[model samples]
Target: MIKWLEIDGQSSVAVARRFARTVATAAGFPEVRTEEAVIVVSELASNIVKYAGCGRMLVQWMPHARGYRLAIVASDKGPGIGDLALMMKDRQSSGGSAGIGLGAVKRLSDRFDIHSTPDGGTIVACEFLAPGLGLHPSIELAGLFLAHPDEDICGDRWQAWEMPHGLRLALVDGMGHGPQAAEAAGTIIDMLESHARLPPSEALGNVMRDYRNIRGGVASVADIDASRGEIGYANIGNIASMRLRPGEIKRFPTRNGFVGNRSAEPLAEAAAAGRGDYLIFHSDGLKAVGADMLLPLHGHNCLLMAAWLLENGEVLKDDVTIVIARVHGRRTHAENG
Candidate 1:
């Protein structure tokens, strides 16, 4: 599960620490690692409160390789740090405060990434992985699934996996919120998973044929072709899809129909996309404005970007799922599997 915290003071810092400890324990980290995670959380929260005055944090224990890891992302729209290299050293104070916070977080985390721009503020992402496992170096992807406020089962479902040519990601929101909707979502995902090797439009078309017996759901799929340097996107319903390239963000209009029932004709859009390009696909449970307002964060870690969007824009009335991914490094696509 993913949780978001609002941090502006010492008390919120304490809350963040507690959250870190809880997730660390739940993720089965050793005691020593848990304490280190607490320290990392405290330092991250303290720096945000002291430098930015107010910011947001996202925490969750997610699957990584064979084991799980705790992911913590802190974001704030304050004055961006200058000379981050100098600030990363011990005792390198910038705001008349102890200069060891960022350095300490980097030291304690198993993996870390930070991006701060004069215009985009700061985003710090860290992960504490379980012992005895290694991370895939070729590709990185992250997503979150949230059930409706009143229901135990989420009608929305999402998945990301690799193909021989590139990567395939999809999000499906079953017709409504409940058992029937959940079943429809399950059916659609099963169909998509079986057809993942096909193009986005063809995959959805497969679902359309087999999904007629079940309740229908909206679906959006994207195929990232590394060789072709293109992103092939197709949608069967109202799920929001965006292509964020350098200096520009493009939003695709919903195809305006369902997969099984009265669906629109299957058509896929292919656009040029190479390294550093990002794609975002989310269900309608999140407001459309959420993605627009967080455009400054496009340069941050994919997990952090996904969390920030959900934290601010969740409509709280339906199941919400958001997946964020970026294309980088020319590693072979099969390396990701």
Candidate 2:
């Protein structure tokens, strides 16, 4: 599960550390690794209190080739670091403490990245693998899921898997809110996972065929070719899909009709997605404002970006699910599997 904690003051640091330690333990991290994770959390939480004054952290468990990993994201809307190079140096402390926090975090993490803009904000993302686990290069995946206020289960679902072409992704929003809606959405998720080898259009068609007896929903699917810097996508109903680059935002149009009930064959389309581009897919539960606001957070950690959107932009009237993915390095044929 993805968990979020707010960091506003000194006390919040302890809370954040406790949350991180608990999650690490639950993920089966060894005592040594869990202690390291706690230290990372303490340092990041302290940084938020010392520098940003207020910020938030997101912690989640991610499946890896060898074992599981702990993914941590810390973000703050404070004055951004002016010289990241200097700050990362081993004894360089901007907060007057031993300058080893950020550096130590980088050394302890299996994967690390940071994005900051001078007045915009700072987001630091780190991943710690389980003891004795080997690490593999991977595409970053991050998203948020929220059930409708009146329903116990969310009708929206999303998933991603590596494919021979690159990566395959899908987002589905079941017709209504409640248990029945969740079942319809859940079935679509299962179909996507099982039939990931099929092309987006064909796979979507298969979903439509299998969803005959269930209440229909809107769906969008995409095939990302990181090597070619392109994305091929198709969709039906109101699911929104978009690509955000440095300054430009491009929106993909979805064909009208519900997936199972009444739907037209969605014509697949292709577009350019460069190294720093962001691909976002979400259910209609998000309003235009919420969707538009995500543009400024283009290069941040995918999970942090999704969490920010869910926390600030959600309408809360309906179930919401947002998936954010960023194209990084090319994956080899072996890694693609």
Candidate 3:
């Protein structure tokens, strides 16, 4: 489950920390690890209170090869950090204290990332693993999903897993808002997870077959083969899928129909996506006019790029979801050995 907290003032810091601690403990984190997570949350919330006046925090569970990890993400619309490198120094204070907050967060997290622009806002994401699970290199993926204002559940959902061939991904946007929409989208996600071993087209067909009679949704699935530098994708309805390579952005084709109610066969398309290429899948809730803004973020970390798009993209009055995957270059002989 994903939880959200608003950090509006000093009191909100304690609230955010408590929320993080509760989530960590419930996720089976050890007491010591839970304490570390609380500290990280405290520091991040404090930063927002001191520098940004107000911000938001998202806490969720992230799956890894060994098990699950805690993912804490903090975002603020305040004046962005001007010098990220300087701010990361142990003693360099942007808010006049000892300034160890961010440095400590980086040290405590198994995976850490931060992105900020002078005028654009700042987003910090950290992932904490259970004890004895050392870091391992995996395919890069990041996604964001938000419900429409005044809604408790988001109708849009995304999921990805590393397969033996490479990575398989799915993005779904239900027909409308609220509980029914969430159920439709979530059911599609469950189907995708269960039938992940099938090819994209076949997997989607299976989902559609089982999803008949339910509220319909638009969906896209992709199989990324990093070893072969290729991607196989299929989509039904309006979910947008795109491939970004050097100097070009190729939008994949999608058939017009609903997944559960009625749909045409979506032929899987193959395309080259070498190292440094990015594959993006997003629901129609993202405005078409703002789609071009993704060009400049081509080479950045997937998490940072996703956050930036979520922050700047025009979100309609519906649930929105965006998923990004980037292919890493071939490993060196020394690293492989």
Candidate 4:
């Protein structure tokens, strides 16, 4: 379960102390480790007040087969860190500009990762391993999309895959919005990643069969070939996929058909393509407008753009999601690409 906590100032300090005691007692950590945990909480809570005005925190303790582990996440929709280096350099910000709080927190934790956008706010996550515990590294990506503000449901889903084939991207947006409409879009993502390498059409067929049990979902799947400049893509329904090419806005739109329920089969054959593809998939949230309107924006800035678009009521009201895959050599670029 997830516990949501909101606090500011000395109250935040007191609450962190109490919460640390509770979690430490339940997990039976050594007094030294417990004190470290408390300090971690205090630093995080204090930073919330000094930076984001106020913030929300979440704590989750999951019991392992051997013991237990803790995860903490603090988030705020405030102006994000514009200069990560200045924020980390300790005493680097001009005057008494609240730099120590973040620098200290960074040094106190075992593992930490922060996601921030000039427009979308920020999320800081830390994971603590109890004595004698260990965890493998993991990767997570989340995308959200909404339809035209006037529309009810947004058609899109984001999924993660870890396999020998590397990471795969799957997104689905149903035809419309409502519980049923959302279910439809969600199901496409569900079926595609259920197996290692099932043909996209077969996955859609299976999802359609299952749709009888639930509503249906529309989806698109792209195999990201990180080594080569290529991506494999397949789509069904009104959802669209595109790659931001060097000088072109290439679009791959699936034919019309409700996934699962199968309103038509002629359009259900999978659409597959080769490399050099900057894959983009969306429902009607995008018209003929291509990535030319989008590619110039920095990758991190793209999400901020998404958040702003959602806030300003420019796109459809339905949920909206955008995924960009830049096929590069095996090296990973940490600059939010």
Candidate 5:
């Protein structure tokens, strides 16, 4: 079971603290554990208000196969960090006053992941594992998944998905670049993620409603029934997508329109135009990696190939991110097993 709580406003810190205490008691966590969670949440939530004027907090508790897991996400589509590296350093301060707020957030969580783009926004995630539980080594072997940057404002973003329905997927490239661009990208991605189980077309429509909140953006949603060898999809804007099988690469075309504005055509109309074998998504960064190289990988290796192309290919000056998912084992049994 997944429990979700979203809180907003200046009192987000207080709300997070109260929620943490409630989660702790319900989950049977120690008092100290609850306090630590609340403190970290407060610090981050406070940063949201100070920096972004407004922010959002999402807290989720779910049962992992190994044990229970807690996730805290705080996001603000505001002026992004100019120097994320320095900001993360324990002694560094953006305003010249030193405080261990972010550092404390790091120390308190079992696993931490942060992504920020100069033009895009920022996403900070904290994962708390039940004491004494261990993560599967195989999961770590995949490394921390990250998107490749494109030239200037590359509006693309992606995340891997595994679901009961099959291998679900998404690719979103916000309308433009910078803070607004990031907001669009994040909004689209978040919507698809929320309805990952729905058909690609249906999920796309759901996200379309929120696109206005970000100004405008383009997105594609796809899901592969690996057992059935079928992949369904919907797309809009210039965000390009493809499917790579063992030796063949297939491209999905996009219909024109910015995300935030409803053109003469409906958002679903663009989505209704389905295309993809498996699926690969790219912002304008596709020009960097030759279109020919898109489908070289046989299975899971596709992700690595995409990463290599983004890093080595000259076409990127903006943020570049590509996602490739296969209905069948993209890797050999021997390789994955």
Candidate 6:
């Protein structure tokens, strides 16, 4: 599960620390890693309140080759650092800049990355790895999700699996907010997990036949067959799916109806996929705006790209989620051989 928090004052530091520890522990982090997570989260939140005056963070237990780990992504619109290299020095900012904890945060995280610009802002991503995971897929993927400010639970859910052919990614949005919506969205996630062997359209067909106790919602699913170098896609309702190439984007079409209902026949189609292509899917919570245009900035890090899009493109009062899957060539196969 992912939790999003806004740091507006010193009060937020404790809350962020608690959230990190609670979620990290739930994700099976060892006692040592959980304490490290708490310390890192506190430092990040304190620096935001002390330097930026205000900022936001997205914390999630994310999937990794090593295991499900805690990922902290913090960003702010405050004065952006002009020199990131200088900021990474071991010295503190002495209460005048935004680089107070960069060196320490870097040291604490297993993986860390940052992007700062004078015109835009700064985004810092830190990841901590656990000890185990089940799948070792060739391609890399990540997603970020949050509930509406007015709601307690998110109504959007997603899941991905390393299929025999390649990767299968699915996202579904419930009809509305609150418990019922969360249940509806969850139904589809469970369905996707159970129906992993089926193709997108057929699996969705199974959902239509067997779904129960939940209001209908939109859904989109994609199967990327790296061996064939193509993607098979299917969608229903308002979820947006796009194939993001380096300089161009091709949006996949969706039928106009709710997914669990007698909606439209979920037709599946195929398209060529390059080694570096990114296939993205999101609910109506995020508009299909210019996320395509910013590919140059957030393209290399799918987790950061997902976080950036959710933070910037959210439609104000709805649940939002985005999944990013980058197609890597036959690297896993080659490594095994």
Tens digits of lDDT, candidate 4, 1-337: 1224676677866786688768876787888877777776776666667767787665555332234556566677778888876666544542365445556656665656566678757666565668886532221222334444444544455665544433466666665565556665565565665753655555555666556535565667666545432445666666666665445565665766666555554233322223333455555665544443555433432223333323333354355555444433344332122
Report the poorest 10 consecutive residues by lDDT, candidate 4. Answer: 135-144
Worst 10 residues of 1 by lDDT: 328-337
- Candidate 2 weakest lDDT stretch, 10 residues: 328-337
Task: Score candidate 5 by TM-score against the native.
Answer: 0.48
Instruction: Please report how far candidate 2 places residue 42 from its true position, in Å.
Output: 2.3
Q: Provide the TM-score for each candidate, comma-separated.
A: 0.75, 0.77, 0.88, 0.55, 0.48, 0.87
Q: On residues 1-337, what C-alpha lDDT tens digit does candidate 3 reach at each position? A: 3325788997888888888889899988899999999888888888888888898887766544345667787889889888788788765778788546677788887778897777767889887886665543435776767777778888887777668857888888889877888888888888888887888998888887777646888899998777766688988889988987656778888888878754466557878767777888888878762436877776776666666666677778778777888877464232211
The backbone clash count of each candidate, in order, is: 0, 0, 0, 28, 19, 0
Candidate 5 Cα misplacement greater than 4 A, ranges: 1-155, 264-278, 288-292, 295-300, 329-337
How do the residues 76-181 of candidate 5 rate in per-residue lDDT, one tens digit apiece? Answer: 6667788877788764666664445576787898766565556545556676666666643222111112223332333455554665535555667665555666
> Which is superior by lDDT, 3 or 6?
3
| Sort by TM-score, top down from the best | 3, 6, 2, 1, 4, 5
- Candidate 3: segments with Cα more than 4 A from true spot: 1-4, 62-67, 130-138, 289-292, 329-337
Cand. 5 Cα-lDDT:
0.56
lDDT of 4 at 84: 76
Better of 1 and 4 by TM-score: 1
Error of 3 at 314 (Å): 1.1
**Tens digits of per-residue lDDT for model 2 on 159-212?**
777766467778889889888888888788788677777888888877776666
Q: What C-alpha lDDT values do all the predictions have?
A: 0.76, 0.75, 0.77, 0.55, 0.56, 0.76
Model 2, C-alpha of 257: deviation from truth (Å): 2.8
RMSD of each: 4.9, 4.7, 3.8, 7.9, 12.8, 3.9
User: Model 6: which residue pairs collide?
Assistant: none
Instruction: Give Cα distance to truth, residue 127, candidate 6, Å.
Output: 2.9
lDDT of 3: 0.77
